[model samples]
Target chain A: AQSVTQLDSHVSVSEGTPVLLRCNYSSSYSPSLFWYVQHPNKGLQLLLKYTSAATLVKGINGFEAEFKKSETSFHLTKPSAHMSDAAEYFCVVPPNRDDKIIFGKGTRLHILP
Target chain B: EAGVAQSPRYKIIEKRQSVAFWCNPISGHATLYWYQQILGQGPKLLIQFQNNGVVDDSQLPKDRFSAERLKGVDSTLKIQPAKLEDSAVYLCASSLGLPGPETQYFGPGTRLLVL
Candidate 1:
């Protein structure tokens, strides 16, 4: 079975400050992890994906995440936060051979000026 | 490339009433998915289709929810005897096919309000 946990339900960051959203996952076998962002009234946009390629994955909109197998963590980060960066973020695990992708509860990001 | 398309951006219905949502996936994409997203939560997979065949639907409420992908192209999801808890956004997504299906493009989603 594969499952993902987003540590925070909401995160508030001041503009120009670093942003971090914590996520962890549990899987018997190796897993594929992803980070997706959703703006207001918009569909989800893929921020990054880790598929055994590299531990440090860089994605669009100056976002990045590092996959740590020992710690079982895949935390998203950015150097700075912008007002437009305020959105809902989700951590996802693709289906294993069993064929079922699991999603985290989601973290709502609030940018403070 | 054209993205996934969904109709009836918003719908308001009474409990126990039936409602339907339509979806048109990207051209040549053989995999389609339906997801339910409640407020303050991430999207949950409701069903998946591979070229007109059902792939996974374990989380769907078979008693009241059903979906069909006809001709391996467009699809529709119907909910009969809707419940208040069913109120959420129905998102339609499509991906290029298996054997390494990468990112799935999503539609705007239909927001349902059940009274």
Candidate 2:
């Protein structure tokens, strides 16, 4: 069995400041992790994914995530948060390779100017 | 390079009423998924189809929820007598194939409000 836990329900960051969203996972098999961003009434946009190849993964719009196996964590980060970066972010874990992608409750990022 | 598409972006109905949502996956994509996302929650898998065959439906409420993929390209999800708790966003996603590790493209989703 596999599951994901997003530590924070919401995060607030000032524009041009750094941003971090924490996620942890538990899986019996090799885990495939992903970070997705969803704007209001928009579809989920893939931010980044970790498939065992690289520990640090970069995605669109200056977003990135690091997959730490020892820590059992995949946390998303951005050097500078933009005003448009405000959105709901989800951490996903596909445990068994089927289409059963388990999602985190979601963290709503608030960008303060 | 068209992405996944879903129709009936919003729906409002009273309890015990039935509703259906449609989805069209990306071209040449063989895997399709339907997910239910309650407010403040993540998307939960409702059903998955691989080229017209069901891959998984364990989380689906079999009593009232039914889904099918016709011709392996388009799919539909139906809920008869939807309950108040069923009010949520129905998201449709599609990927390339099994053993995933592949990015699943998602649709805008259908927001259902059951009163």
Candidate 3:
């Protein structure tokens, strides 16, 4: 089974600061990775995905993630954080066979003004 | 394109009562999924369907939960004699179901509160 672990449960940052959400994945081989965002009382929206094509995956809202096989990490980052960026971020992994997708416990981001 | 749709954005029920939730996937999407998300926990896959056929439902508690996708487009999940643990958000998602990994679009989710 493929799974992802989010390193942080909560992260607080000042506005316009860099944001880093770490994620480590466990898989026997190359795995499909994704990032999703969920706002308060809203459905989850796909931020980005890496399907074994590119090492650097760019997502919406100026967010991006890098897939590093050596480290088994697919960490999400942003150069600058906006107030609207405060939300729950989830790291996702899907099995190679495409049976189902697994989501991490989620990292809650708080942007301070 | 319109995203997946789920009915009853919120529901309140007492223990031992029954409730049903409905979902409609994106147009022409062959794969649909249902998940249960408790507070402070990640969403757990309850069931998945590929064009009206069950692909994986090993995690679903079949004893009190039942789900059906009659025409491969609309789906429903029902809980009988609900328990307090059943209080959670039910999310519905759909994908194109191509040969490889695909992006899943999620619905607004139905929040159920079992008191």
Clashes of each: 0, 0, 0
lDDT of 2: 0.91
| Isolated chain A TM-score, each model | 0.94, 0.96, 0.96
For B6-99, candidate 1 gives per-residue lDDT tens digits of: 9999999999999999999999988999999998778899999999999889999999999999899999999999999999999998987654
lDDT at A12, model 1: 99
TM-score per prediction, in order, is 0.94, 0.94, 0.94
lDDT of 3: 0.91
Give the least accurate 10-residue stretch of model 3 chain B, judged by summed lDDT.
B96-105
Candidates 1 and 2 compared: the better one by lDDT is 2
Candidate 1: the clashing residue pairs are none
- Tens digit per residue, CA lDDT, model 2, B20-93: 99999999989999999999998888988889999889999999999999899999999998999999999999
lDDT of 1 by residue, A22-79 (tens): 9999889888888988888787888898889999999999999999999999999999
Q: Tens-digit lDDT track for model 2 on A10-96? A: 999999999999999998866888898999899998888888888899899999999888999999999999999999999988777
- Which residue pairs clash within candidate 3? none
TM-score for candidate 2, please give it.
Answer: 0.94
